[model samples]
Target: MPRFTDAFRVAEESGQTMAEYGVVLALVTLAVLAALTMLGANVSSALTGVANLLP
Candidate 1:
């Protein structure tokens, strides 16, 4: 009984920690996506400028 309770607590903690990590990863992914979206047009324009200058 005591061992089972201990195991349950550890499992619950692990699950909670994993959930927290997943949330952090999701937030970071969203931030990166937003940054790329905001910069995409500028980057495209810059590339076009460079291409026009090349040939």
Candidate 2:
């Protein structure tokens, strides 16, 4: 009984940790996407400017 309880606790902890990691990964991905979105227009303009400067 004690061994079973320990196993269950370990499984629960592992699941919780996995969930936390997933959330963090999702948040980081969203932040990166947001940063790219905000900078997209500026990046486009910079590229256009560079292209214009080329012969």
Candidate 3:
């Protein structure tokens, strides 16, 4: 009985850790998306400037 309880506890902890990892991954993804969005316009304009300078 004790062994079964211990197994269950460990499983629960593992599940919780996975959930935390999922949340962190989601947050990181959002941050990357936001950074890309903010930088996208600047990058586009820079490229356009370079293109204009080209023959």
TM-score of each: 0.62, 0.60, 0.59
lDDT for 8 (candidate 1): 52
Candidate 2: regions farther than 4 A off: 1-12
Evaluate model 1: give its TM-score: 0.62
> In candidate 1, where is summed lDDT lowest over 10 consecutive residues?
3-12
Pairs clashing in candidate 1?
Answer: none
Model 3: CA > 4 A from native: 1-11, 47-55
Stronger candidate by TM-score (1 vs 2):
1
Error of 3 at 50 (Å): 5.8
Candidate maximizing TM-score: 1
Model 3 C-alpha lDDT per residue in residues 1-55, reported as the tens digit of each score:
3676666555347778899999999999999999999999999999999999999
Off by over 4 Å in 1: 1-12, 52-55
**Residue 46, model 3: Cα distance from true site in angstroms:** 3.3
lDDT of each: 0.89, 0.90, 0.89
What tens-digit string does per-residue lDDT give for candidate 1 at 1-55? Answer: 3676666555347778899999999999999999999999999999999999996
Position 22, candidate 3: lDDT: 100
